[model samples]
Target: MARKASTRRRPRSGSSYRRVKKRSCYFCDSKISYVDYKDITLLRRYISDARAKIRGRRSTGNCQRHQNAVARAVKNAREMALLPYTNQ
Candidate 1:
């Protein structure tokens, strides 16, 4: 089941990391309106290195619009055999 977007995960107990600052969207900064499915290098940055899953908005610092675009691009790339569905 998917967790609600409104609810946030609690910080780990006794962790060194504390509060995290919000990050600016990369697409907005670059002024890139379109996300290219063929851009493997660029798309790979948004994907998990180990699990091959898409990274959340918080992790990638992507805006909602761009994040959706990224996910679509990834799926297209996968269908084209340009990117592996899983790293393994």
Candidate 2:
């Protein structure tokens, strides 16, 4: 008598089985970095919907200190009108 071969199950359609990789913070890796509120271009990337919230360490791959700095800089930028208070 012949044995039947085992079949692997297929994943469901439109389902994603892989974990998405998190992005790293640009500043932390550079090391010579200092976050300045005055740098509008630099601060804009972190802002979402015209408000800045420090991205999670896993998401941005930034250390706690740098994330705090990013938040501070974003606030200052908003106050100074370098960045908008809310997205239009």
Candidate 3:
């Protein structure tokens, strides 16, 4: 039987020394207890500029608690007209 090609990429020989840096939570480092909807500047950082969508925890590097708070704050801000519902 013929062998099928795998979807996964094979690592190049002798390039295994690369290390990924760990992401740290910004809110935890800054000692923030709550996310404020009225803080447009702060909220903007966690939003996608092109799509006006809430970024995921993996992308934003936010802890679980802070990510939840960020989601709520983004929703409230949008409802209050402080933030846009979409880029359009």
Per-residue lDDT tens digits of candidate 3, residues 1-88? Answer: 9999899987666677575676899999999998999999999999998999999988999989999999999999999999999897
Clashing pairs in 1: none
Q: Runs in model 2 with CA error above 4 Å?
A: 1-17, 49-58
TM-score preference between candidates 1 and 3, better one = 3
lDDT by residue (1-88, candidate 2, tens digit) is 9989879887655656765777766776788378989988777667664444545567666777888898888878878888777655
Better of 2 and 3 by lDDT: 3
Candidate 1 residue-wise lDDT, 1-88, digit = tens:
9976867687676768677789999999999999999999999999999989999999999999999999999999999999999987
Please rank every candidate by lDDT, starting with the best. Answer: 1, 3, 2
Candidate 1: Cα lDDT at 39: 99
**How good is model 2 by TM-score?**
0.63
